[model samples]
Target: MRQHQNRSLKERLSNSAFCHFEQRGELPCIVVQHPGFTASLLPQGAQLLSFCPSGDTSWIWLSPTAEYQQGTSLRGGIPVCWPWFGNADKNSPEVQAAMAEGQPLPAHGFARTNRWTLTRLYEAADRVEIDMSLPQSHHIQSVWQGDAELTARWILTPTSMEMQLITTNTGQSTLAFSQALHTYLPTTDINATRIGGLSGHPYIDTMTGWQRKQQQGDVVFQGETDRIYLQQASPLRLVTPQRTLLIHSRGSRSTVVWNPWITKAQRLSQFEDNAWQTMLCIETANAADDWVNLAAGANHCLSLRLTVE
Candidate 1:
């Protein structure tokens, strides 16, 4: 038994060594080898993780979890939550309750927790693809009997990044849903930076003592800001004096931006102290109570590509 175990270990080591050797070349995809940077591609999309050695800048993109952890929670990297998209109720009751009946999932639906299968891995280009079948979940099947295909493709370039999500309805009936790419970007100071894009639109302010009002210019961060802007036609941009990160998307009809200031951040133990200043949530989504109905044999696609300059 001991000898067998040793052989197994040796085989595993040999496989790893050979994988590394095969990856060393002008391959189209490559895994990032830096201390805090790792890249992978599934049948869905490419996912990149960039963190400090101290584990501070750790960010994950499931390429499939696009809802941005709802408007309430946005500290744990950028999750692409999907299906029943945005808020059904702006104030009380919240959207989770509205989705309780006849709905296959909770507020933002159950796309995030499902285990995605990796279909392809490119060693030279740092890319991966993940794929999942929707309406296949036990909960979803009980509520809505249908089959859907969701594919997420993530590609990491030397200077920029890209993610694509494609959903196809394979069942006989139509599928109704909403989607979003929840992005949580790390920053030195959220207050110092201004979020561009929705310059002249009205926003429902979720901060203390502030009434819902129309924003005059580009949305700037003074204190804590959490609002879901309606019918925004512009792309989302996180602008700082030092750098600017542009989030461009297609097939999404709504956009959400959120930040938990000092008080809210303190209450959440996972995000303590000045963690608020280090992160900002800018999501590209389809919400505002909008439902997408895809007929059988129809497919819908949503994509968000980020470029940091």
Candidate 2:
């Protein structure tokens, strides 16, 4: 049955000029080779693994040792954190209360590990667009009791790559969730990497007992860092020795900046010990004190746009 499905998917996607199905170890993925850029996307979790614009190196950072197997989350690109971000116990009460009693909650929810259904693919002279949705099935029912639908869309153009995460409440009651576009970007030198547009904003320092502190200047990497900046209002500029990337977001009031540095990098899966020095995460999020509550039949959309110069 699995083989038949793979064959059908391959035939269907292969008809497109720029998109086709390919196997990556134990997993199946779509490879898009548009005139503007090239991208690799996995239906599993609807995860994007790589994006390289024409004439430039990859703006997205994927792990060298990342695994491509069933039931395992890849270590890089943009992981769609959904339903709840991080520890369920740390989420807002409304999000926590929605989970089934005594059900084991995985970090960053279950969206990233489940296979999503491809819903749409459209190509044009200058761009390509793709959409995938999380199917309601045993995977969802096992962890959640509410009825909600998740749809992710991507648009690739010569100058930018954009993503939108849309959540709809299909149940009769209200729905609550936290989510993030956990984007990992690469840097040739971590010491020279700096993030702008967050000065004076307050952040929760998760590594320092979750204390709240103010951002005094452009955020720079020094050691193991995990922070959730609150009430963010502007786009973030990531300046590295390799290139400059701009991150613009909507429907997000928080941004998570993280790097495992050295010590924790040794313990991370699908990551090399020195990988931390070359990658940093600037997540556009609705997490920590920022969460979403949707009324019955309502929908919410979180979007992120990435451009390099």
Error in Å for residue 48 of model 2: 0.6
The local distance difference test score of each candidate is: 0.53, 0.91
The lDDT, on a scale of 0 to 1, for candidate 2 is: 0.91
What ranges in model 1 sit over 4 Å off? Answer: 1-37, 40-75, 86-105, 123-135, 142-146, 204-213
Candidate number of the best lDDT: 2
Q: Tens-digit lDDT track for model 1 on 64-144?
A: 222222213333544556655544233123323324455534445556544344444343433323233333556545533
Candidate 2 structure, TM-score to reference: 0.98
Per-prediction TM-score, please? Answer: 0.69, 0.98
Q: Which one wins on TM-score?
A: 2
Off by over 4 Å in 2: none
